[model samples]
Target: MLGSQTQTPPKEASSSITDKTKIKARYFMIWRWHFYAGLYVIPFILMLSITGLVMLFDDEIEMITYQDELVVMPEAMTLPVSIQLDKVQTMYPHGTVTQFIPSKAIDRANKFDVRLADGRSVLVTINQYTGDILGEIDRSDSWYQLANDIHGTLLLGQWGDYLIEIAASLSILLIGTGLYLWWPRDHASIAGFLKLRFSNTRLFMRDLHANFAALFSIVLLLFLLSGLAWTSVWGGKLVQAWNTFPVYYTWGDKPESHLTHADLNHGSEKELPWNLEQSVLPESNQHIHGAYTSSETDKGYVATQNNINIDSIVKQARGLGFTQYKLFLPQSEKGVYTLAANSMGGDITDPRLDKTTHIDQYTGDVLVDVTWDDYTVLAKLMAAGISLHQGDVSVFNKALNAVFCLVFVLISLSGMLMWWIRRPSGKTRIGIPPHFESEGLWKAGIAGLFVVAVCFPLASVALVLFGLADWLMFKPRR
Candidate 1:
């Protein structure tokens, strides 16, 4: 009995040691992942945070930078829409006016997006009452537009988009692993929950990094998921495809044009609601009234006052209760006029008020009209979420997003600083987290990898490659 008792105590002690060893191994495994994720995501986080801030406050920036063009004196009476178009056409005789953005405020200058003869798009600002040419800015060259492009595509087109998408996807894993590391193991450790400590240099940086992460984890995740909906592979091809607005229900057996609402977008700058991007546009030209024809005038070839002219379109928009809106001109004879008022176009602050109406270019007949209520549940969420992400909801939203961006930069910098401070000096190798080899250590992470693969295929591919490289180059210390 004495021998059995001694043996039982040794067995319990051995089991306890084994349990602790596995726990430590798991910690190192997660920490290693967190480290690499931070390493790759650091630069991207900086770029995105900066560019995101620029985009979030694009209106304010433009107000300061282009006040002459964006702002004007308020007048009691405004010139007619056709006259404005005629004035713009007189200035750019060879340019194709594709879109007209009308400001609801009387003091703001009206905008006309014209494609010059050289195939460059420029936004021409025209005074509403006086019809004076304020100025023309290259749509792609504007600071806000450039920042928006970089924010979405990194100026590398599809390749840049893919890179950003990969970084964003892996960031999910970063947040997950970070949360796990921040989680307290016991009551004593719980004191540090979201509390920043500055007593020691390492602890200060650590606390800053971890605390900000914990503080903004939920909001950051919301941003990531909503932003992912714009990605080519995961969001566009998958989630977007699945949740795209049902055109059949709205159009009711009408023939669809080859072009979609995506054609309305100017590169990465989306002008349509998320669910409507893929919606098939309705064809026109079934009722071409002779009165609704284009004519050449001394000013320029402009749409005259007719049944389907620019004036009628403006009236139609107003009749439909569109206050601030954009009119996308029909491209071809069969193209339909698109009147859009949505948060995506920065026309309104509330996503619930989003509305898009397609009008027959020749007949002026309403083809299809979509409102916020027409959207699917997921689409509605995406619209509001996107508005929130862009800081278009309210002044408070802008302030919160700005704070988040600033803290994100701080967190990213602190993470890199901590890594740099801890890394071995004058060493070519990164001071990777210690690795422990235990039976099924790799297996423990398989479920997570599978989930990631299912949700984000590109991120999973990256994880696989990273895991293989780590296994080959860095053997377990144990």
Candidate 2:
């Protein structure tokens, strides 16, 4: 019986062997792709994590840095908005007041964003209660803005943008394959994937990397997606096109302005909410029955009328159920008055509270009123995701994001170390995972490659380069 059993394997044994081989093949394929993606993602992810962590506390940092300018005692008799504008306009006669940001809390100074005639922007602080100009800061010189530029572009301008897009694209593959590999095998306890194995150096780091990455996998993915949704190619060109807010009504035949909200972000740290990512702006029409609209006169704009007109607009904003919103002043001769608020850090600090309104500068007609509910399904998701990613939504979210960033830094560094330590000694070539020959690899990969290429063109370019190298030097020899 033993000799017969040895000579002819049982059907169950044969099936088990086939399943094991299949799992091994799948593991190697995933591992290979994960390695390829990591090579490009590690440096950029580290930079993003670091800069993001810095930007998470931007509000608090700015408050601390500009405390003398931002603070005020509680008082009911606040200065009129026009008086504050007059004070700033007179000081920088060469400047135009673009936006007035009120403190969400009453007991604080108001901010005026002025565009100087010399082509610079400055943040002017005026005490609402005292009506005194407190301090002025050149907007571009802010530390957070510099860090934000680096986070977005590595300080390399457009080239930096492309590099980040490629890295961000490949990161999708990195995290996806990582989760696949991170799944516990054979119904094993959480020890391998969740619990860190510190018994051995390589195993300890590997386990630590796996466990932490697995823990933060969902959060990491959300951050990556939100960040990508802001990128030039994937988010701007592909996603934002279909996800942009659609205009529903028009008061006149006035053609929309060529500029979108993005035009406003040209020289500023503030960004438009994701919902307005691609909405065409409406232009001011001369037909609305009004003499220069609200708070206006025939001889150029001035600071007077006790803000009775804008207060009505504020009342209207309140009537629309807005508790907190920013009133961005007209930017040009035909610029509109924009009352904006979103969950982003600038305003109410809750993504669910998003609201934006654009009123004609010449006629004071409501051009557009968009609330959270008006956002596209994709834009709504991006709004919430972006708030979480920015860590401005909650203390817990901010702390969790910080932890994830730290863990990612550890995972990236330790991953490199693991490869270095475990590499085949004395080998001239990279000690890549053993890519055992599988007839289905190229065929199976084609579908994924095509999908990635369609979604992220820059990453596709990287993959094409890698594919060429693989076919030339790394393809398994039969």
Candidate 3:
């Protein structure tokens, strides 16, 4: 017995009472932090949610509401691109023509983009054949523009933008903490996981909140991430880091290469016999300035001759089987005339816009031609994503985005309800307790300092006041 007297298997040790108390205290602290923070963020969340939903179907709404104005003709005799530009210049003589959009739809004519000397860009739609001004679409009237303003700044400008950024950062933290709280202690029991009983009002509301949140958590996260990517400086850097491939411009010659007449093919067009010595570059010069002159006395820029009449161009482009066409006039001496076309409605896969031709401003010869099929894989993917996001691709995507917007609105409402229910009732609840009444004064002070350090520098001053209050009350109970 003595030999075996090995201390009766020392009673298995159990978790200490102190350990249990500490754990309880820690959980309470986290709960209190969440309650306070959630209460503060509810209003902002609601605003963001409502605005986001409205923006989701903006493209569809615009199309439906402004059908007559947005639509265009596929083929119509039009003035040359240069002449159209000249008309725009005269209309806004003090401004310069920036770009042109050719028509692909039968209802629309042509559009010219002009930049005033003051630096404001204006859109001017013109009749392709007669060069008659049709209408002007100002950015101020754009619903998408308004949505972006509200989504990014709550219409408050830079200060609002900063505040939203802070709110978004807090939202991420809130979501993480919320998920942690939702996790069950016992993995085997699914009792609370899928429960949605509506017998009790409070419980039913809780279930509704939790279930819907869980269902769309991933999508919400994606929206938040993409939005943050566009708002934050660091987020922009991250995007740039991921997009490392250089974007190439095939229409222009690189510094290391010299493109000559021999390097280019005229296709079906015959080269006119002209003085090569006068038109070609010097042996010592690497740059080429190709311009066609109809007469010695009539001096005009090379681009003037190459500019296609918008009305005639549209008719010819339609003959090529294009249902829609968009023309972009050059911005500078070296720029080329760009034409793009697409079908009536949007189709991501074959939405039909193509940068099919780039004509020389001087010779009126096609300088470059590329179809939709010729786009790089990344470019195509980007176009598709944009179309989907804008609700321009398919009805299905539009419906899905519409639902997403509604979900955002619901989320905001739920957040507001939760906050309204938990607002503190008294002044005492508004401030941290003094040291004499609460041992947590020091801890609270530390927390205040930490929050200020991370959130706003101005908060640091408030934190100092909190520390002073704690010192005055506690002073180490001697």
Number of the predicted model whose TM-score against the real structure is largest:
1
Q: Please report the TM-score between candidate 2 and the true structure.
A: 0.87
Cα lDDT of model 2 by residue, 1-478, tens digit: 7766757689999989877887788888889888878877988888888888788877788889989988888786987666677788787766677777777787778888887767788889988888888998778788788889998888888888888989988988888899888887765435676677778888887887777777777777778888888788888788977787564433246557877876665363555687585777776654453344333432224422223345556566667777767777665556666788887535766776788888765445678877787777787888888888887777898898888888879888888877777777543357667776566767778888898889889898898887787678766431
Candidate 1, residues 1-478, lDDT tens digits: the string is: 7767754458889999999999989988999888877878889889999999999888888778888888889888999988998889889887778899986677889999998777788889999889999998787787888898888889999999898898999888899999999889966347567787777777778878888898898988898899889999999888998787574365776668878898888756889998988878888754444455564433233442245788889998889999888999876656778999999778899999999999877767888999998888888999999999999889999999999999889989999888877887543368888778788887878987899899999888888888887877766421
Lowest lDDT block of 10, candidate 2: 297-306
Off by over 4 Å in 3: 1-44, 60-68, 71-87, 117-119, 129-131, 156-159, 186-192, 197-201, 241-287, 290-302, 305-328, 334-387, 424-478
Candidate lDDT values, in order: 0.84, 0.75, 0.50
The numbered model that scores best in lDDT is 1
TM-score for candidate 1: 0.93
Identify the runs in model 2 with alpha carbons over 4 angstroms from their true place. Answer: 1-22, 186-191, 247-254, 266-270, 287-320, 473-478
Native-referenced Cα lDDT, model 3: 0.50
Candidate 3, residues 253-369: lDDT per residue as tens digits? 422213232112121111111111011111211135444333221121223344444444555555656554445444445555444443211311254364355454444455555
TM-score of each: 0.93, 0.87, 0.62
Task: Tell how far residue 74 is off in model 2, in angstroms.
Answer: 3.2
